[model samples]
Target chain A: MEILKKLKILADSAKYDVSCSSSGSKRTNQPGGLGNSASSGICHTWTADGRCISLLKILQSNNCVYNCSYCVNRVSNDLPRATLTPDELCELTINFYRRNYIEGLFLSTAIYSSPDHTMEMLLQTVKKLREEHNFHGYIHLKAIPGADNLLIEAAGKYVDRMSVNIELPSERGLRLLAPQKKREAIIKPMTFLTSNIAARKAERRKSRKAPSFVPAGQTTQLIVGATPDPDLQILKLSENMYKRFGLKRVYYSAYVPVSHHPHLPDISSPPLLREHRIYQADWLLRFYGFQADELLNEKNPNFTEDYDPKTDWALRNLDYFPVEINRADYEKLLRVPGIGVKSARKILTARRMHSLDFDDLKRIGITMKRAQYFITCKGKYSGQTAMEEHLLRPRLTLSPPKTAGPEQPSLFSFSSDVIAPEDAFSSVTGEI
Target chain B: MLDFVYDGSFNGLLTAIYEIYYRRQVPQQLLSSPGQTPKLFVREERIITDETKAGKVYEAIDTKISSRSLRHIYYAYLSEHMEAGIWIYHYLHLGWKLGNKLDLLLSDERVHRIHRLSQKVSMERHRLLGLLRFQLLRGNIYYAALEPDHNVVELLAPHFAARMAGQNWVIHDVSRDLAAVFNRKEWVATDFTLQHRLELLKEEEYYQQLWQEYYNSMAISSRINPRLQKRCMPQRYWKHLVELS
Candidate 1:
């Protein structure tokens, strides 16, 4: 087949993977090298789906041996299959990089023939990009499950970031949908990569020139809504993964239906809003000092679609509200419904010079519409007359004001405006 | 009321600030050349840009404030806001008195305005670094043109220099008629006019087609959101973008 035809099939197959970050590793171009990875990732462009295309996300081959029900590349799908030669992949990456189309390559492969063979092909492509092409740009490689420990380790040294996708949340879901992939097959490589990365860090501390091992860190993805796994169970598993294996991110891809299976949810599209809420709760877990249990529990298995996870948490624990803005510490300031990490930091830095009032808070980038009920400035409250949940809940749940007209251009707006806090969290966590 | 006017340059702005301090007079406004209409009792003074005076003020600021704050000042200057000259003056005034604590003085209107202005310019510069596209032209020179809201050509040049070290490239700010030309080893800024139209390399069209194809194939059709795409990459940037065009 022609290279472009293969590219279309392979890239289309890989679109569902959804991890597009090319960040957290600061590798500068060597004397004769062609590219470099920035510490903060750059989004080259936004696709029509409103997703950032940061990397050339493509699969080496879309011909799989395993029958994962949720996947498009599963063995029984009967879609057009295509694989690129290692040389073809390298040429595409270099050409795209030269044209400023992408930051680097996000190379994944299906279980073509066997796991070891697929991984070896991936390793050869990445190694060739780094060594022969002198490409020093960001490369995110997949740590193929059930691949040999030595193969995973050797590949880790060449790439900036690596991930082993835990496709389903629970072991039962894995068995029901993807019977070939055992829980151990996924977790074992993650554990091996984590320990090897730790050892490499220790080695680098002793010697400045020691080669890095997965410097951007490992991330994983879980297909939500495919099986009957509740939000609480999924989040708990994610929390445990973060603690145990030191994963940088856990992406939740709302299960987009591809195959007509009696066992799977009979939905045409993924439950994006649910995926978005999980991401919001995930952010609270990572940065906002909230535990998985705090966000959702056994009683409340799913987050409400009406309000964001943070707002929901704040409303439930009203005793924590009426926080004194002037005297509250950074942690307390962060718990407010409307305030984000950036706004919270702004408040911290600004409060040192002078006490902040409601007007001052607006100027400092706080979302006053939601933050008003939760905060007090200089012992004064500017919230509604009644602080009851019934009254405040309706106010917090109101949609954002609409733009003047559809064609009225917003010159200064950014990607943050496109994705709300929860949506931003979902996209960033998925990509990063 | 005195209106201090200077050449429209960062050094000129700094010199005006120095004059404000030296003369011990608070000006009604600081105007970049092409001063506004003068009132009966208002004095308009044309202050020439002096590198020595600008250097002295910058050195003092570097000593008193953090280098990060200095960058903020530079970026704020690039914003070219109507009141940026006055805002920077007020920021430096506080920086001198409070030293490094001026960054935390966000409640102060002047300091907050400058901080926000700096952020706007810096964010644009950062965004353009990724959004900027280059078309390979004849003579092996890659050329790109953008009309950013702020003056960020100089800010973006060093980044491309390091990333595309061995290549020849030119980033043209069509709005300001300024171009940053990077030869194989080094780069310099030059005043450019669109006198001649250059043809793209034959292979450029083929690669652009492939990129557009890849871009279209990658998006999930079920989740198409043009509103969000517009917000992330504004329509203003779409003219030069290969895939969008």
Candidate 2:
């Protein structure tokens, strides 16, 4: 294909990947380098959706040998196919980077010809940019599942971060939606990279000269709502990845219908609200400190559609409430509904100097509407106690209707109130 | 009742604080204006710019609270909130009472509110460093203008020179008409104007094209959340956004 035509085709194909965040990497421009990576997130561009676009996210090739049923670029799809030569791709990225159009590149592809061929082309493009063009900016390379270990290792050496998307949650789900890709193909590379990363980290601990391998670490994406796996199953897989594979993040892309399939539901679009809720739950896993089994099970595999994960947890475990604000441990303080990481940290830091009363807790910015039932500041409870053990649905429904806006429901409204008490507690504790 | 009115400048504000502290006459209201008439029962004070008084005020605040806290107070002033003056007064009072231990008052919503406003101001200033787009004018002076929510015009002075040190640049806050000028060697704040027929249209058009191209390339049509977009980059500021224009 001609260079310009090839560029458009590859760029359009690569646009589907949403995990283009250019954060968690800090690289200064080398002596002959052309770019810099900020520690904090930088906006290279703002999309119409108001999302920050930092990287020139594109695929090297959309020509796949494997047929992933959900993927539009899968081998079976009769789509126009194109692939950019390593030099052609490198030139495009460097020109864009130099012109201040993009911060770096997010290079991914379908299994073009074979995993090795696709991976080799990706490594060539990135290595050429680093060695020839001297481009030192952020590069997030998508490590192809079942690719040769050497290619994956080569990608790690040049790119700031690498991610191999798990695509589906369970091995069963993988078989149903994308038959060619097993759990092992994705997991094996993740396993290898994790060990490689650990070994590199160990070397760094001993000496300062150990070169960084994927300084931003590894992240994976899980397609939500495609299969029968519940949020619990998804979170379990995510938890295992975090604990065992040491994956930095497990992105949940709400399964947007790309192609018609017998096994998949004939829906207009993936449930975005469900996707958003899963993200919140995922945040609970990573930062808020929640566990998977604590959140869902075979009986209740999905999130409570009515309440947030934390609020649901809080309601389920109501006996834990009325923990004295002045004496509760940091973990206990974090469990109070409406109390966030910031407020919890503030409470922990403040109680060092003075005894906290109900007024003090309010002053510290606790949303008493939700936290009151769960906490007692110096043994003072300012919240309604009767609703403490009530299921979130009825209690949240009881808010006075004296004031209501057209767009925004009352803060306690199920649709509007995101950080439900139980959900909040679960996320905060990393409990299931 | 004593009322002290000062020019809307940090130095002038500091001078007023100095007079209040030195004179030991507590005011009924500390407004930031020059010519407003005080009530018949009130004592009025006109605040003129005095570097010595400003220094003394800075020193007193630094000794009482902390240099960092004083900087936050200045940041709070730049926040342009209607209650900024009151927040400053409360901040000063709180500083005197708690000293450096005031950060521990994180649970106090009032203190937290002021700190949040101060943080907002700082965040805006940092954002402008990345967002500010300069256009080369007729006089070889690279000019970028903004109507920032915060008083970021002053905050940008230290950065422009380091990045674009070779060229003369003028970053103007069009709403405030205050500009940060770097003359290749030294940088200072000035009230600069378009003295010549310098066409901003060509530069504006170039930026418009580039921004639109980037915007078009980046958006995932499936994930178009205009409401969320509007919440982040408000429609009020769309006139200045090259992409939207």
Candidate 3:
């Protein structure tokens, strides 16, 4: 078949994978290669639906042998399936790279024929690019769930980044949604990679000659809202993956309704806002010094629809706020609802030069409206008189609608009505 | 009042600043090029740059201000600020009064403008490090060119050297008529009166054809949005962008 005709069918089928990030790989040009891979950063270009199409985001083939209920590319779907030869894909990548159309390639595929068959084709494609074609640009390859360890390791050596989509949070969910896939198939490759990373590090420690192994590290994506898994369960799983596997990232994709299955919920699509909230919470867990337990529990299993995860946290832990601006440690300063890393650093830096006051906080660009309830500037409060949820909840919810723009009075007018930057700090729990 | 005329380089500006301050004479009119006349009734005295006088001025400013501040002053001079040369003189005067807190003057809108201008120049330097695309010509020489809005060509030198270490490459700022040439080991700037002899590559046309083919191949006709593409890659920049061009 013609390359363009085959590519369209394959890419269209591959679109539902929802793991198009080309970030977190850091490889540079070698002697014979024409390009390099940047670390954890891809020039992400998104479509109108906010789909990342920056890379040649495509599947090598869509001729699946396994029938997964949730997947549109399942064997039952009788779609116009096609596969590209390794040389065809390599030629296309070089052509595209020279034109500056893409930073790199994000290649994934369905289990065409078998897991080994799919992975072998992917391995050949990447191997040809690195060895024969001398194509040095970024490559993010997908590790087929049940692929052989040798094939998986071989795939890692050629590409900058790799991922094996968790597909579902739990094994129960996996069985119900994707019957052919197993928990061991997904976890084994991850465990092998985790051990491989350890072995590579040890090799490096013993001798300086050891080559880099998946320099960007492995990442996985879990389909949120697919199973009966709560956000708490998801976060717990995410936290464990970070601690256990040393995974670089755990991308959470809110499920998009792609099929009309009898068992699957008839929800149109997973709420985009919920997906956005999960990402916010995910960032809090990763960057902000918050643990999954700290953000959620049995009582607060899901993120609040109205307020962001951080704000939600700050409001629940109201007593922790009113943190002293000049005295608070970096971690404590970070916990303040409104204070971001940039602002916290500014506060720390500016305090060294001069003793900070309420006016000084404003000058340094702290969004006092949120921070006032949580922090104090020179023993003064600049937030609301009522830190109680009844008064604060309405004010917080009303604030977004009331003063969302330039037409409204300045949001800063609450300084006298409140007290100091301290009083503003604890007013809300803004995590994300 | 003394009027001093010097070359337009950063060192020339510093040497002129040194002359005025140490000589204990304020120039009513300072011109970069010779033969410029100031308004009538303003006394103009030309001060020739002397090594001793310049050194004393440099030492005093270095002691009063800071080495970091001095670098900022140099950056401001290179910024080609509209009234930057004159502003530097005023800033030095402010520093003399303000002691170590000379940066307090940075709060002023005029000084802020200089800082903003310098930041703009610095930001372009950072972005170009990742954004620059190099193409290999027929002669085995790599030619990468840019038209950045800031004077970031110098800042881009160190990064490209480390990244493209073994290769012979020419990074040319087309608008500035300056090129940073990395020949095997050493890198240096060249301002050629005649254009560079680097042969135009047939590789470009090859890449261009491939890129156009890829662009057509990737674009979903079912989900075409020229408006979104235009938003991400503006029409103004399309002529130089290898994909669009």
Question: Per-candidate TM vs. native?
Answer: 0.94, 0.84, 0.77
Give the local distance difference test score of model 2. Answer: 0.72
Please give the lDDT score for candidate 3.
0.68
Query: Residue A31's C-alpha lDDT in candidate 1?
Result: 90
Across A1-432, the per-residue lDDT of candidate 1 in tens digits comes to 988788899999999987888889999998977889889899999998778999999999999998888899998998999999999999999988876788999999999987888899999999999999999889999999888988988899899999999989999998899988899989999999899889999999999899999999999998888999999999999999898999998888878878899889876556776777788788888888889988888999887766788889889999888899889988998899878788888888888878888888887767787888888999999996577888888888846533555444232121223345435534464311
Candidate 2 CAPRI classification by DockQ: acceptable
Error of 3 at B236 (Å): 5.8
User: Model 3 fnat?
Assistant: 0.06
Winning candidate number (DockQ):
1
lDDT of 3 by residue, A1-432 (tens): 876677667767766665555566567677645666555454433343323355777788888888877777888886798888898898878756543456678888878777887889999999998899777778888988788999999888888778888878888888888887889888999999889978887897888677767766788998876677778888889898888999888877656666778756556435444555667777677767889999899997887655767778888888787799979988899888778777787687667656788877776557787777777878777775666766566555412323343433332121121122222112112232
Q: What share of the true interface contacts does candidate 2 keep?
A: 0.34
Please state the i-RMS of candidate 2.
5.7
Ranking of all candidate structures by their lDDT, best first: 1, 2, 3
Clashing pairs for model 1 are: none
Model 3 residue runs over 4 Å out of place are A13-28, A40-56, A98-102, A133-137, A265-270, A398-432, B1-8, B12-119, B129-146, B157-239, B242-245
**lDDT per residue (tens digit) for residues B34-148 in model 2:** 4344378877777787889999878978897888888888898888776676567767777788888876777665577778888999888766655665665656766777789
Tens digits of per-residue lDDT for model 2 on A1-432?
666556656666776676767788877665535677766756544565445567878888888887788777888888889987888778777655543456688999878777787788889899998999888878999888878898899889999989988888888888887887777787888888899989998998998778889988899998887787778888888899889988877777767678899988656545555666677677777766678877777788887556667778777887777788788877777766677777788788789779988777777666676676677777776665464455444764323333344544322122312333343223223333
The TM-score, computed over Cα atoms with residue i paired to residue i, of candidate 2 is 0.84
- The per-residue C-alpha lDDT of model 2 at residue B90 equals 67
Per-prediction DockQ: 0.56, 0.30, 0.18
